[model samples]
Target: MSTHPLIGWAVVHPWPAAGIAAATLAVLGAALWVTVRTARAIAWPPGPVLVAGTGALVCTGFGADTSWRFARDGLGMTDTTERAVLFAAGEIALFACAVMARANKTATSTDDAAGTTGVPGILVWAITGALVVPCYATSGIVGGTIRAFFGPVCAALLWHLAMGLEIRVARPEALSTGLPAVVGRELRERLLSRFGLANRDRTAEQITRDRAVDRAVHLAAVLELHPDGALSGYRRRRLAAAVARSGAGTNGEQRHRLLQQLAARRTSGQLATVPLASPWAGTPVPDEAYPRTPLGVTGAQLRTMDPLAAVRLVRAAHPEDSPAEVAALCTGYGVPVSETQVRIALRAGNQVAAAPAAPRPVLASEPEPVLGAGLRLDVESTALVHPEVQSRVPVLAAAGTRTRQVHARVPADDQTEPQHTAVPDAAHPVPAVPEYAVPHNEDIPESDRDVPDPDPLIEQARTEYGTAVPSYRALKTRYGIGQARAQRIRDALGGTT
Candidate 1:
């Protein structure tokens, strides 16, 4: 009934109806395959839907093919290409409608559970279907058959453009849901820096070596969060880092001073005071600001007091000062509070002067050395913990050297002339006086004393009575510390009147 197009084209002859139809269908199938490949993955949209939809479109295309055959053979309509093109275009339209319907059905079924949705599905269906419209219309317009194809092409184009319009209409709905995530992530990092959360993995030796980059990253995170600088977050982080560095060293005095300053602000409200030149001026102040609490005169007040009294005073003033800070502070002033002693003082409501722990006496585990007359001996070791040697060696060393005493009552003018008779005694044998027989104290075992405890009472009172009490409580609860500590606070005695 028709010649093959290839055979016709080879001889430079015009293609017959069947040849034209066959060539048109072959090209359309290849284009559809390419369109589907570009629009969605076989893995993503599921292979079955693409396959089923494609089969339907192809079947519809065959309807156009049969129609064209009828027009060319049964009715004497000779434009084979135009007939084939219209059939392909109509089938593509039907295919597009089927893809959209299938996609919509899938979307509705999975909407609640889908991690991401709607846009991807619609894009897949719309773009695939729309790509075919032009190819089909171009086929239909062949051999001057333009009028019959324009309507369907326009309708497909209109449907394809609707996806962009819908996105604009829906954008407002997503703004609220997305904003909190952006804001919260930024805020929490800044807050943590303000609180000075330390990394757990660092060793004292590592920090002493100044390999503190891990600590620095956290500080940077805080700065990023506090960009507007409305809060004192930056200062808090700096203070915390300084305190941490100070605690892990022999030169802890400076760190203790900083901590004391921090404590002073918390208790006496001295450091928290905003002088007339206040930066955070808009913040409300009380109508009658109380006068600063006096911490008493320095050395004179401390001299006659109970040993633990100073520790309590520091605790009462600076409840937030770390144990290291308090110990270092007391150590700076020659107060000798152990780290544990400082902690206990802080816990006892800053009332009982921290009790001094008695030094354990060293037992006489070794034999005493005998000293010959006129041959004084002394030995000293830097380690001071040996009980007998602790007091004995230092005393012997000091006693070995005599004070400026009258050397034999320095010959009172004439009376010393009789002393020359002593030269005769060497023959009488002042039996070999041993050359400074100083015995070394064997090395003492290293003391494994525990550092003193921190005061929980002042800390608890500060929580109950501090200026930002509610906020502090909220932080405690959030961090999983219970409200019982808050309830037991001495500062909360009168409750929030």
Candidate 2:
């Protein structure tokens, strides 16, 4: 029925047809297993090609085995190993085509998602079925049925290859066991650098040792979002690391000092804080929807806002900038704004969502307690309020301290003035006045030596007032005599009048 030995033997011996078919199927299955194993052990397109090529060879071998006899008789193989040589050549060509196709697909896939290596779903089977056409011409039903299985056998080998073409499945990031892996792994030590997993299951000592790196990575992420040079968004740790990286200790004093400066900038208005995007926080808003600037990304909705509304938003965004500064900034941005315009928007407050009001600084003006020896006053207790401290603010003015409000008009509390009853410390017994003007001190008695002649000043005071007993204040005012001299005159007035 058939010319081929194996096919003829199976046909002549009816009982063995099933056995021969099973044996052939078994061989094909072995070849398929090896092919799949090779594919798993290798990389992408090559793995796929190896698996496909091996199947192609195994399927081709069913009709065209590498055996010399088959090469010589049915095929045109001349040399001893020519059959294998030819098959190998075919495999190489197939592999080259597959690689070129994959390369083309990879290039195009970047721009076109649908662009990828494609294998016809029915190709192997179709080819195998076509090859079986010759079998039907040679053999009757029995032979035809046996040889017809060649198509299925070949297609079965290529099943994995065809399936792989449709879906380019990727392996997860997993390291394969090998010498390169052994050499590549960090030999010193490995620490979790991921922010999310940083502290997880870490011991106190490990955390303490690795915190600097963790902080640095965290800072890097923050800068990715906000990206302000001196601002607090994500640069504090980066700036600190720069100091430490330049040979300071991980938590060294120099590093700490740099960090302190950054912290001060954050609190003062020197550095602006902006929104940061973090993995832990989830996917960031799209760049188109959230436009980015030197400060940060603002929502796309800002594009629709009117001029006044936009100014208000800018004011809110950069609260650290004064209204005039913001106005100048807007004008520079070609918005044609002025300081007055910004002020008007701020006062209107309705155009933009306002930020929470910051707490105002209260300067302490509570009177300082005069804690020294002579007198004491506690604001809480209300002991004699220091009238001199309140009224003598001119004292501070003289010393170059300007006081806005000095209660100079408020009369000093009576307790502060000297007691008038102090009859001027009993003056050196008033010596009798010398009779002549400009009298020589030697002409006067020793007891009366230092005494000034009050007769002229006395006559002047007596003429101005009703009597010679001139009051100390009246004598001081009219004669311009000081308090001590006036006291002496007043004492004389009593006896003389």
Candidate 3:
């Protein structure tokens, strides 16, 4: 008897089902191995990957069992084909998720901040879920309805956990509120520079010190905005030109020299602007100024020259000097410099003499030729004592007190007598006149230099008595001179009297 058509159909379906199972195992194993390798490489806080992998494997087994039941129950219907399709699609998505999780974790290790791995981890799970859920829907409307509700919930939880793991590996530290806000702007600038969309104003070392996420985002933005330098980027052409003019070989050397030149120009208001006769002036300076340049002097020739000459020649020879070369020159000279080490020594050889201090103001009453100290209290007294004297002079020290006697002579011959005196003439001398004819000169006229007027003072008092004479109370209280004039009165006195 001929075999039933149903028997043939059943036998062919199991083989395809078995083929899918084998393929699923192969794919899952490769994906699992990738995850394991990534986890091993980081030697991360170990348990999470193992748990996650075990859970995925368990989910895969459930999917396989479901596939078998659908194949057995649906037999030859279109639904049976759909079941196989869902099974294959779901396993593929799970495999993709596994691979993505490992990739994200590996990427996190490279990032400085682990928490920054959030976006990437979520992206992986999202893409896989988006693709995988449709597979269940294709199998049967009921299967689609069930997975639609639950798949998202499970994928979300897994995504979050994967992100947490990635964060721990990438951004071990927490960020402050202000840091996150600034990160976007920082990232934008970096992106523009990386892709040549914007001028790369900052150097490599400067970028290294910057945060990693900001740098990555900057790189990404640059690439996005100007994939082919199409945006007509910013040119730090001014800085580059300045560097060239500074005659410095490297960026660092150029910065140092430029700063020095700017400062010097500001102070002196002059710069070395050589006037060229033509557009292509040969090396700016004269031939004598640069003896070695035309000759193309080697290192040995440089050593043979005078040390100072060598330094000059070195500077003149190259259009620019690198910081390293400048430093090397400084080392050779046994001098140290923090910047611009090869700068020529500018100190003059001779010392300048100091000018004398100007003379101080002097008093009319004080004698000339007095030093400032000697006249401290006198002359226009040292300006130092003027205030003190005006306030009331300080009492003289005991050692400063001194007294002197002055004498006066009274002549015995007051009336005219036979006395004669010879008066000298400028150019000629006459014989002395006889005593009878000569005029009497009274004791050098009894010099009135220190003597007070007697009769004149008495007469002046009669005309201006109230103004001239002290009041009785003032005389008695202050000077102790009462109602009478005495020529010689004994008085007791203190220092400097």
Best by TM-score: 2
Residue-pair clashes per candidate: 14, 0, 10
How do the candidates rank by lDDT, highest first?
Answer: 2, 1, 3
- lDDT tens per residue, model 1, 1-497: 78887776756754565687789899999999999997666444334434543444444444455445545654466776766555344445544564464355334432232112234434544544444444344354462133223333333333333322233233423321123335885687677556443454666664443333334434545555575675557656673675466543455654454445444443554545645666586867664222222475364455456767887776666678787787776665556678878767666334456789999998877653435533333444443343321222134555444432211222245444463423323323322222222221221112212212232543555565575444325533444332333322322333331
User: What is the RMSD, in Å, between candidate 1 and the native fold over all Cα?
Assistant: 40.7
Instruction: Please give, for residues 406-494, the per-residue lDDT of candidate 3 as tens digits.
Output: 22223445434655744534343333332322223321123322335242333433354443443333322443332222111111000
- Tens-place lDDT per residue, model 2, 114-195, is 2434453234334445445444544556775665565335534464354344334342232323233345654313434443
Candidate 2 to truth, TM: 0.24
TM-score of each: 0.16, 0.24, 0.23
Q: What is the lDDT of candidate 1?
A: 0.46
Best by lDDT: 2
Q: Which segments of candidate 2 are over 4 A away from where they belong? A: 1-55, 63-129, 138-142, 151-454, 458-481, 484-497
Model 3 poorest ten-residue lDDT run: 488-497
- When 1 and 3 are scored with TM-score, the better candidate is 3
- Candidate 1 segments whose C-alpha is farther than 4 A from its true place: 1-150, 162-413, 416-428, 431-497
- Worst lDDT run of 10 residues, candidate 2, spans 402-411
